[model samples]
Target: MNKVEMHHTIMAAKARKEMTWDHLSELVRKAPVWLASVCYGMNSASPDVAARICEVLELGEDVAIAMTEFPVKSWEKTVPQDPLIYRLYEVVGVYGPTLKDVIQEKFGDGIMSAIDFSMHVEKIEDPKGDRVLLTLNGKFLPYRSW
Candidate 1:
């Protein structure tokens, strides 16, 4: 099957098995977000990671192979409509400049490398409500003048 087809199959199987991305990440030995991205066809998995994911999900070797294929990350919308996603877009819209300014002050004319980034999501307990904490770690790449 193709990557998108395999992604659909994976999602269906995950739902059928009542599996969480966190649980799958543990079995696959990859980060939860990264694993979710892989399953969403936004990222590729390594051979070992693909094997583990297939084993855990009881998927075929073909699906595993598809997982190992490189992904073409694309999105149709510039402004997301989903509330959860829109909130993120809003945050970036509001804070992106400040973040860039701060980063440049510290790192000096550099941009954060999404190509070499790692992220984690955590839940913090509070009396009001549980808070979602997202930690993004990326290498800083300073601009080089030739």
Candidate 2:
């Protein structure tokens, strides 16, 4: 199966099993966000991880093999309409320049490495409303003079 087919199969199995990403993470011993990304075909899984996931989901070999393939990692260039996703895009649109300036000042002429990154999502409960917390951690890579 291809990545798209793999993602659809995984989602269907997950929904049928009524399994949360957190539950899958506990079973597979992986971070929930990363695990979800793998399921969504945004990231590749190691052979062992793919096997473990397929075992838990009762999926066949094709799904596991597809999971192990590297992803294209591309998204639409247009602004997202989904409220949650749009809010994140808006945050980057507004703060990107400021973040670049601050990061450059603190870390020099370097960029954050998405290849060497980890992200976490958390929920903070309050009387008013619940809040979402996101933490992005990436290695800093400085430019090399040629």
Candidate 3:
């Protein structure tokens, strides 16, 4: 975890702080979820979409191109680039428990199942205390939705 990487935290915070649903929507020239959908690579964003998003998000043309032509890997699950996912890591680091609480309240007994999940863990022993270190990451979607 290394405390979830500071640079990672900063970018996610910036995205959450600066990007709004309207802004993201207008950027994609579509619905807000469409931005997520676009980022998720479920669909291709047109040049108009790319231009709008770049302007609103203040993303440079090159990065905008990357998003527009985002590669679609045929894994059963999807993930974004490292920097983007790290941004998500920052969000979770800051709001993890709150999110967990809200999700639990909403879903009731249906926590994010880690089946098909992958995580890395290491054990380190020390005079202070034996440590169990972990980096746990997984794609989250409703289990039944899969």
Query: Which candidate ranks first by lDDT, i.e. highest?
Result: 2
The number of clashing residue pairs in model 2 is 0
When sorted by TM-score, best at the front, the candidate numbers are 2, 1, 3
Candidate 3 ranges beyond 4 A from true positions: 1-17, 26-28, 76-146
Give the least accurate 10-residue stretch of model 3, judged by summed lDDT.
1-10
lDDT of 3 by residue, 28-82 (tens): 5676544554555544567777667656655556545555564444443344458
Sorted on lDDT, highest at the top, how do the candidates line up?
Answer: 2, 1, 3
Q: Residue 71 of model 1: what lDDT? A: 85
What tens-digit string does per-residue lDDT give for candidate 1 at 12-89?
999999999898888788899989999888999889988899899999999999999988888876789899999999
Candidate with better TM-score, 1 vs 3: 1
lDDT of 1 at 127: 100
Model 2, 44-69: lDDT tens digits are 99999999999999999999999999
Tell me how candidate 2 scores on lDDT: 0.96
Which candidate wins on TM-score? 2
TM-score of each: 0.95, 0.98, 0.37
